[model samples]
Target: MKAIVKSARGKGAELQRVPVPDCGPQEVLIQVKATSICGTDVHIYEWDEWSQSRVNPPYIFGHEFSGIVVEKGNLVQNVEIGDHVSAETHIVCGHCPQCMTGNAHICQNTEIIGVDRDGCFAEYVVLPSENLWKNDPSLPWDEASVQEPMGNAVHTVLAGDVVGKTVAIIGCGPIGLMAAAVAKAAGASRVFAFDLNDYRLELARKMGATDIINSLNADPLHIVKQETGGAGVDVVCEMSGHPAAMNQGFKMVTNGGRISILSLPVRPVEIDVTNDIVFKGITVQGITGRRMFQTWQQTAGLLQSGQVDVKQMITHHFPLEEFDKGFQLMLEGNCGKVILHP
Candidate 1:
């Protein structure tokens, strides 16, 4: 099968033919239909500090995808051949404390596909049947492929109630854009989207942001303050990993509001705990991956029901051989969700 392999410890990947993997007794073999480029894939492509320390080279490295079950191992029971599906990226130990108590998304021994094993940037990939998420047969392949990341947006935005309240999304990346849409669909009175790039901010507007503010041009805190009559926003979804923007998120949320953070900053971020958190009496949540199948269920409902349409946000597509083009757009921050057909 043709696959995009990270052949060396460097800044690029190579398209090469590799042997198709065999399905284990508990795993299933999927024929890749469509896959999406993620920020983590960009980190791996750039060989950044996080990728260098986490991923070993010479492996397939993409996790977001939709595929069809072509073959299944003898013990696989959750799905059958010919099922359309996406997957939960995190593979966890079901016996751990987190897993046992229904918090498997944070299992101590979690193994993420693409990071810990060969990923879906190929014609064929194998995964545990337990991780498979059945997709509606009529769902578009590209849209279905993005459920994993959309799950992240759903988990972050819905961490607290947004209904009838003002919410601020502190980034305009793909997930941030989705958060704007989710907040709007969840009945937020106003959705303020912030980002440095106009291209993404425009996309955020398309995704249902009531107001778009380019943080580079206008002060997000000031604009939000004026818009909200000095009360600030009721809910803040912190998707920008930048320390400065994160601090802005802390400052712009109203007293007794909620702040849910999903971005992973490279370095330690400094915050004014006394004034921004304690005195304001806000609820701060550190969001990780989706809340297991619950977030997945909500994400699927939003997409399937047309309540949160994502078609406008998926701005680009490329063939698997042209993986570099997708990565380039992601690096430049000029595109939304980029899907790759295998």
Candidate 2:
């Protein structure tokens, strides 16, 4: 099997011929059709500090994918061979307190597929049956592959109410663009898209962002205030890890509003505890992965119903061997969702 492997430490990955994995009793063998690049994948590709501490080299590293089951173990009853599927990347410890209370998305002992174990970036990959999401046969392969990251957008924007309210999404990356679309479908009266890149801001427009603000050159807080008649937005989805952009999100959100942070900052960011949070009576949440099957159901429903069409945001495609091209585009932040075909 040919896979894009993080062959060594430092930067970049290589296309290598690796031995096909054996399916375990609880696993299924999938023939990958489409896989997408993620920010975490870029971290590993660059051998950044986070990747250095977490991932071991020479491992297949990609998790967002849509594949067809070619073989399955006897114990894997949930899905059979020929099932079109994608997966929930977080393999959780089912016995944890968070899992026991139905918060398994934040389970204490979570092992991420691409980061902690071998993942889908090749012609064939093996994953546990419990993690598979049976995709609707009608969903396009590229669209299906991105449901994992789209699930993140759905989880963040829908963490609280958005209907008939205003929303500010402080990032225009793929997930952030999806956040804009989800906010619109969820009935947000106005969805503000913020980013330093104009290309993504335009993509956000097509994704249903009511207004686009380039925070690099413009004052987002001032613009949002003027747009909302000084009341500020009712919801702020902070998907940019930049400290300044995050603090701007805090300022742009209305009092008694909700702010969900999905981006992982490299270092601790300073927050004005008195003004941006407590005094304003706002709700701040640290959003991680999708909420198990709940967010999955919503993500699938939105995509299936055409309420949150992602066609506009899925901008690039390449063959498995050209994985480097996709990575370069993602690193440059000039593309939307980049999909690779195996």
Candidate 3:
């Protein structure tokens, strides 16, 4: 089987013929149909500092995918061969205190697929049955492949009540765009999206953002406050890892409002603890991956119910052999979710 692997430490991945993996008793072997490139994948491809510290080379790395079960282990009963599925990338330690308390999304020991182990960037990949999400047959493979990231957007938007509230998303990346759509579907009275990229800001508008701002020139805080009658937005979804955007999100959020942060900053960002958080009486929540099965259910429901349409966000598709081109588009920020067919 041919798989894309980061066989060496520096930069770039290679398409090489590797032996097909054998499914373990608790795992399922999926024949990957469609997979999507993630920002994490780019870090690994570029061999960035984060990847150097975490990713071990000679490993197949990709997590977002839609595939069919070609075979399953003897112990896998909930799913069977021929089931169409996608998976939760984080393989949690079921015995951890967080898992024991139903917070498995933040389990003490989590092994992410494509990062900690070999993942679905090949003709076939293996995954634990517990992580399998049986995708609706009607859902397009390209759409199903992106449900993993979409789960992130859903979790962030649903973290607090958004119904009839004014909300601002401080980023217009794919997930941020999804959040804009989800916020609208969840009944947010006004959705303000901010980003430097004009393409993404336009995409955010299509995703239901009432106003899209290029934060490079526009004063997001001023516009948001003026629109909300100087009270500021009721909720702020901080999806941009930019330090300035992080600080701006805190300022745009109304006092006693909620701020859910999903971006990971590359460097330490300074925050005014007194004015930005403590004195404002605001609630700040750090969001990570989806909330185990709960967020997955919501993600699937949003897509199936047509509340959030991710099709438009899928801007490019390429065969596994053209992976480099797809990555280039991602780096240029000229496209949204780029799907890879294997």
Candidate 4:
């Protein structure tokens, strides 16, 4: 079998021939059909600080994928051969306190597929049967491969009720664009999207943003304020993770409004906690991965109902041999979801 391997430590990945892995008793073997490149994949490919700290070399490294069940271990019961599926990339310890409390997404001991172990950038990959999400046969493989990230967008936008309320998303990356669409589908009266890239801002508009603002020259807070009659947005989804964008989101959120942040800043960011949070009586929440099972269910519903269109989000497709081109497009930040056929 051929797989994209993180062959060295410093930078980039290589497609190399490797022996096919055998499924564990509790795991199932998936015949990889389509997989998508994530921002995390780019970080690993570039050997960024996060990847430096977390990923070790000689590992297969992709998590977002749509595949077919080619084989299953003896203990795997519900999932069987021939099931079309994608998976929850975060594998958690079922015994953790968070898991017991129905917050398994934050389990103390969580192993991410692509980061912690061998991943799906191969002809075949193995995953715990429990993590497999059966996809609707009608869903395109490219779109199905991205459900994991789409779940991130869903969890962020639906953290609070946005129906009939104004909402502002602080980035127009793939996840941010999806959040804008989710906000609109969930009935946000006005969805304002902010990003420095005009290409992505235009994509956000197509994703259902009521307005788009390029934060490079214009003030997002000012535009949002003027559009909302100075009250600010009732909800803000912070997806940029940049210090300035974080501050902008804090400023654009109305007093007593909700702010759900899914982005991770590269370094420490200073904030006026007293003025930006305490005095404003704001309710701020930190978002991680999708809620286990629950968010997945909602994601499936949204896709099946056609409330959110992710097909428009996919900009490029490549075979496993052309992974470099996909990575280059992602590095340039000119593309949305990029899928790979193994």
Predictions in order: lDDT: 0.94, 0.94, 0.92, 0.93
Writing each residue's lDDT as its tens digit, candidate 2 over 110-191 gives 9998899998999999988999999999899999999999999999999999999999999899999999999999999999
lDDT of 1 by residue, 69-178 (tens): 99999999999899999999999999999999999999999999999899999999999999999999999999999999999999999998889999999988899999
The alpha-carbon deviation from the true structure for residue 135 of candidate 4, after best TM-score superposition, in angstroms, is 0.9
After superposition, candidate 3 runs with Cα above 4 Å error: none
TM-score, cand. 1 vs. native: 0.99
What would you estimate as the lDDT of candidate 2?
0.94
Tens digits of per-residue lDDT for model 3, 134-223: 998888899999999999998999999999999999888889999999999999999999999999988899889999999878788888
How well does candidate 3 match the true structure in TM-score terms? 0.98
Model 2 pairs in collision: none
Native-to-model Cα distance after best TM-score fit, residue 282 in candidate 2, in Å: 0.8
Provide the lowest-lDDT 10-residue window in model 1.
213-222
| Residue 21 lDDT in candidate 1 | 98
Across 1-342, the per-residue lDDT of candidate 4 in tens digits comes to 989999989899999999999989999999999999988899899998889989988899999999999999999998879999999999999998999999999999999999999999999999999999999888889999999999999999999999999999998889998999999999999999999999999999999999999998898878987898999999999998899899988988899999999997768889888998999999999998999899999999999999999999899999999999999998888998899999
**Candidate 2, residue 195: lDDT:** 95
Q: Model 4 misses residue 85 by how many Å?
A: 0.6
- RMSD per model, one decimal: 0.8, 0.8, 0.9, 0.9
**After best superposition, candidate 3 residue 258: deviation in angstroms?**
1.1
Better of 1 and 4 by lDDT: 1
